[model samples]
Target chain A: MTTTTAPVRRPTDESQVSVGIAMVFLLLMAGYFLLPIYWLVVNATKSQRDLVTTNGFWFGEFQLGQNLADLFARDDGVFLRWALNSLLYAGLGAGIGTVLAAMAGYGIAKFDFRGRELLFGFALGGVLVPATALALPLFLMFAGVGLTNTFWSVFLPSIVSPFGVYLSRVYSATIPEEVLEAARVDGAGELRIFFTISVRILTPALVTVFLFQFVAVWNNFLLPLVMLQDSTLYPLTYGLFSWQSQVSRYPELQTLTIVGSLVSVIPLIITFLGLQRFWRAGLTAGSGK
Target chain B: MTQLWRRRTLAALAVAPLVALAACGGASTEPADGAAPGSADCAPTGGPVNLSFTSWVPGVEEAVTLWNQQNPDIQVKVNDVPAGNAGTYSNLFNQLKAGTAPDLSQVEYDSLSSFRLQNGLVDIAACEGVTDAQAKFVDWTWSQVQLGDDGVYAVPQDTGPMALYYRKDLFDAAGIAPPTTWDEYYQAAKTLAAADPAVKITHFPQQDANWFTGLLWQNQANLFDISGDQLSVTVDSPESRQVAEYWQKMIDEQLVATNLQGFSPDLYAAWNSGTVATWVSAAWGYSTIRDNAPDTSGKWAVAPMPQWTAGAKNAGNWGGSTTAVFAGTEHPAEAAKFALWLNTDPASLEILNKEGGLYPASSDAQSLPALSTGVEYYGGEQIFDVFKAASGEVDTDFTWGPTMTDTYRFLSDGFTAALNGQGTLTDALTAAQTQSVDSLKAQGITVGG
Candidate 1:
């Protein structure tokens, strides 16, 4: 956490009691957040019987290697297929979503368009409606065009994140008017200027948008649940849900669900670790000179 | 039926009930060909056929894979949907509305009438060998697929005839024998409770309205009687009251665990810890006990359900499902063939049973070599023998209505209230009866009040 950069002890400025309380509060919050994942990782490595009988926070008889092997080998590696589907949906959706967001956000912030506020207001309205509330209506809309079970049904909806646009518009204020006018006068076309000069200045903030969109699509359940009927097209979340539901008939899937969940989150972790510097920079950019 | 275990929640989605009505009035009856076999045309679409089948059964794809190998031209793709009454029904409804539903889908027997009402399933009885295959399935299951010789909408896949699953170690330790009648069962409950404060004879889970429906079935409490469009709804009646009052006595005496929910981790742990003794469940429940409480292997055994009258044999049923070929499929004949083989073929049946714990509804499969053998978990007891006997005693005339999802939800709500001390179990039945009749009427099905 970024808390590590902050000194807990400030002998001249703060008392030890406040420092102690702050440290304890931060530790408790971390433990609360990490405990469920820790339980999943620990249980995923255990046999089915051990899952219920043994301590949830500790290891059991090591089935970690076996569990991973069985998970991948299941249904001729269908879990891997789901993983690849998730990657495609999230990675490409986030890439395209970020570019679109940057253009819209920069246009709204920098240009004096007639309906700029009205367009931004619509985006705010989109943010107010939960994705779950939209899934059914979205499903009906897609079904109208014979696109319900297709990849584009999920991918198209994933690329239209209003929150991503909102974040970008707020961050576009960081780009200077002088730099853009200089590029414009130098005969760089508007599209070229937006892509080259404006987009580069908005890089860190756009990374923040990309990460948010990526995780939302990666963990999306209801959209895929409503939109897709084919298991071959399922994302990691829906695939694990289907397996978990069948645990009564096939008890082996209980552990597999646990292990699959643990495995599904690895890419999210990697993405976060790789891009957190850009994300953190975005968070602090508007705060200071 | 609780046969799917932890099934029958809330209600299904807003299904397009008029789709089937439109199909009748629409000019899409052009597929009839190659001479009418019985009721349906039994026609196959021209050219090589590829079929899609959707099911929630574990390892069903492997069975389809087996079928695909032998009939290379008539390939079946298995779509892994969740259990029926969950998202699968809604998914099927969505696909049906979109006209992109699979050639076949798995539907529970209880919900088959609803699907029939919605006209989701195709009439495939006229398909080659389908009429001849009727004699191969058990009497009740065969009836489940047909609608008064008009057509057969599906093939019988599995049955869930009710029986008793008890912990033999706990029973023997308490100096109690397995109960054979309701009176004896009550006596055993008192004995078990007195012997140890920690244990009860069994648990009567409030959420399991499907299980309760099975109990009512044993008493010959038929919920619906359809004549033309008229449906006689009697979920609350003398026979149902007899069964409810009997369980109400146990709940009053605290002989059953009302705190437990069926198919929950708490129920599994209760069985493992010997806090719960017997489970009056279906033939498929044998696997449920074995799989969940793995540490309690060899302590469990199965027997016929306790009778209502002395020396009388009667059985109720819980969960079972059918593989229905959906309408609008271009290849009905090939889909019907795949559905038939998946259920009745000995090799495919074995795969389904071993991998998914499905008790075959096929009469000949009842005597399969694998079924006749002893299972190691039950201390080498030939458990299927008990199931076979129970299967024979299950009343073939116990009919389900088209809006069972709504009826089950109302019953479950009432049952939950009754269990929590708001009403008697008998009152829950009365409420369920009124609500069920209303539900049927609302669905445009005529109901006798």
Candidate 2:
């Protein structure tokens, strides 16, 4: 390929026009993605009165602090409690579950063993089943074992991430088996090799798995709604729903629900922004290979 | 990536403290105080009972709290589920299949036939506080909770008698009096629209099956004729189509504003602001209007629902629920007793009404001076009298076929489709009826031949 034959266009009128169009399109995409979050933030700052009176997307009086204070005070700061429960469920479930999925995926991808394809296929099939369909069976199984309403009832189910396993396997497959065999030749055990070698190479995939699991568990409602009867154990989604259901009766909750919705979204935004690099990297790695 | 990992770790570390905080806010609601004498000792000998009572309203909290206080030995827990009539009841049936059935739960009077057919509930007619209390309720209301074989599976909650709530100021602004007939109501709405396009005379979500349900009930159209275990929807009937077409006309003429269903928060605000002129709602909606639309106080007043004909029944029930004991409860006696007291006891009703703003279901309790007292919110309009008179005429005998939820949802969707001119009224009705019958049969609900 000669440099002279290559089409070179820099700062031409057509190029500039295309760039302008691209900028506008990108801005629109960004707006589309951010609109709901923006509305939530702006809406959170308004009192119930302002929420109804003013345009939805624009800022009203800056009552965010008051709304948060009221939100925390509602039914004795139950919203905070729900947030805590969600964090516990999603955090531990995602953190440990991601590491396990990484190890399992690496084993399936790098190791040549009987039933490896079967195991991967099984995990893929598991992902195909809707979470709601499993809720009842999960409840009955937990009820039989006296695990219903306990934290473990939700945590145990969240720990098994089939999608996480699939991604990890695909990720670890790129880390050539030669690297692992070399580590083994150096007297590193399988567990040690998996931890100190494969995991570092698969960090991008691991982070993606963790974030997916974290969001899945955090947003999960039906499972926890069916499994946990004790209000204290409810995650943020279920807790918010409980508060929302009563809003028809108690209009005071309208502001609190909005505020609660806003606060719940903040952690997710931080998580996404922080971990988005890993997600983007994982996608690049997959497509690049 | 490291930041994401740090966030996850931080979120994980924060979980314990957050859960502890949520645990602090637990309402730990138990039954209300005081049970009828000897009702406590009626427990059947068994292992420590773990029965459940499911209800749709916070009103049942008073009863459950009372039971927990008075009868701790039996130990009945309550699940105040957060869904509407169809959603919650359907969940109950699904829970039964899942073998996680509550000991007691609420069932709609119209939906009672389906519940009865399933035989999933216990016969509480034989329980204490129920057999003798039947006569005290309005006979029609009592018959609603009664299943076949004389089994009373549910305790009656508040009745949903319909009435017209209009902003008097808005009406005066439009230079029209309160409407007494359907034609006059449309005329008033048209005049109100001309006076100010923003001031909608009535705001009903044409897409919501609730409008259809209320209209059909008001016109006394039996949705289905139930024979033995069979069910059939009468949507092809003149009255059913009449209600559908009336709503279609209202939409086409732009007299009624289109909003999403189930207590539209925006329209509620509009109503308070005097932008929405009139709303046809049940007795319970009064509480919502009074609470949410505080600024519209003396500006709002109750009137009879506009009639289709001069002598036709002028009201229809919109939303009402009942409390039933699930058969899985270990404290059946205590649960049933509590359910009864909550539904029937005047003191409990008084507390619920005062605190929760629930209209009383008990016949005697409705006569309390407080029930008739003028509300300062409505400019001292004594609406209790209006609600009380209308409650008597609200049809109490609409068939809640097994496909009740599906029918309502399909009809609601079809109504929207028709109103949007996507389909004709006949096409919409036929489609809705077909979908409803299919859904009912799928649920194993035998449609009447």
Candidate 3:
């Protein structure tokens, strides 16, 4: 490999200017993305009076510790309950969703079945439909069954991510049929072969599907808004939105909403950062082949 | 092939619910005649019964807790439903249609007609002492809870009689007294703007249609008139045009700020920094100002809203909500009693005033020691007395239209465009008038111009 390697060329002077401009553009984009989060952090550390009076980007009296204390202590620590509800909804919802999508995708890709294309087409249609359009109808059905305003109402809809199945199908098709045939030749059962061989090959793709569904479930607001009435079952997004609408009457909720927003972002950040390696590995998996 | 067919069938089974559910839309289980499944007796039974109430008022839980402790037999479970008027109404409407509504809901005076027309509220006229307690509340407020002379749908919990709150320091610096008439208000705006370039006499928030409606009401502009079932829309009448034209002139001259949305962060900042001199607000605004602009304490004072004609004492309401019993409640009697108790009982009303910061709609409750005392936040001023006097002057004949939500949305869009200098305020009012007529017609209601 070393003997046949090609030499890389250095950037020309004109290209260097273009590269510099591109770097500047990227830095500006990064600042655009981060300014709101920066504002949130700076404002969350302020007293209720200071929040309105001070500049949004600058530090106030450094009340982050106190704000955090108040956030957890308000309404008998309801924020903590909302956070836990969010984790339960997104965490379990994404986990089960990924497994179901992977199995359905693998079955559709490998099996020579009747109506396979039709089923895939149906799921693709689901991918195109916006979730909000389905919320009201779903709410009515669940209400009919007396299942609404419960945890299952939010979780069940969250687990049915059609886009995840579509992504899994595209990725699973890249696995070679020869590998499965070889496993069959070795007398391994189809289930055993899938568990030991296909699952390993599909790990990177599955991780990508998991992250997408996780974020979608984490940020879902309208479904929970329409479905759940009990505040105890509220996910973070709906809970914060509920608080925000009442700011006109309960002005003190302004600080709580700001601080709660700042706190809600941390778990998502950790989730993305921790799984970033898998995201990259998944993107680059088929490049070598 | 058989296995393949089985797999295909399983996949089809998964999608069946989506189609079926969409087709089976929700329907109201109760009859339109208000014959719900509950005993009509208004007396509260001495048994443990849990009642649910939905409201956005903060610290309402404290009032509920007080009631819960006193009457353990009839416990009220407070649901902190946190959307303001429109959102709460829509949510309650949905639940009512589904036959799963809470026992009681908070309905604003402006939106009460919509709820009553939809049959979302029960006739509480026969509830214990409801008709007799009508004499306890302000006449206009009591009238709002009734449909003509026979239908009583809600209990008046609070009133939002409009008032003028001004920064005394800014007024003194500009050497102008609080204007008691519309002409004086216009002159004071000019004087205040000339004294300080950064200061405006007040802000007319285009996004707040309720506040604009109050101004129109004070001018005696009957935008909507209901005679029997025939609704007439005259939103662009001469009286309304007069009020709109005067505001347009002020906005064109830049004597008042029209860009700030009410209850927005910018408005809060403006109040805190003393850039805006006066706030034309309702009685409920006292708590809003005190909580948001704490440092501005002792610099503010309350007075009656200025009049259209010199020395006229006409006033109008901006925002206030009532506790209405749902028709589908399982415990109608208990729910009715709780609604009455929450609004009229002196002890419960005291908790609402001191903790929840609500201005009382009941005349007797207005004299509660908590409200009668001078407030330190308003510079030792008996602010409630000013609001009390203003409340007494509101036009009892003035009524809210049944399609207020849609009408307000159209008006807000028009006014917001006008405020941004895209068009004149009169033109916006005309557009809003046409839109309101069309929307009401679309609802199959008779409309006349």
What lDDT does each candidate get? 0.82, 0.71, 0.79
- Measured by TM-score, how close is model 1 to the native structure? 0.91
Query: How good is the docking of model 1, by CAPRI class?
Result: acceptable
Tens digits of per-residue lDDT for model 3, B131-158 = 8888989998887787554668889998
Instruction: Tell me the lDDT of model 2 at A93.
Output: 93
Kindly list the per-residue Cα lDDT of model 3 for residues A177-234, writing each as its tens digit: 9999999999999889887988778888888888888999999987787677677788
Segments of candidate 3 deviating more than 4 angstroms: A1-10, A185-187, B1-48
lDDT of 2: 0.71
Cα lDDT, model 3, residue B399? 71
For residues B127-201, could you state the per-residue lDDT of candidate 1 as single tens digits?
888888988888888876774335788999999999999988988988988999999999998988898988988
Chain A TM-score values, per prediction: 0.92, 0.91, 0.94
Score residue B276 of candidate 1 by CA lDDT.
Answer: 93
- lDDT for model 3, on a 0 to 1 scale? 0.79
Q: Candidate 2 - CAPRI tier?
A: incorrect
Candidate 2 vs 3: which has more DockQ = 3
Evaluate residue B319 in candidate 1 and report its C-alpha lDDT on the 0 to 100 scale: 87
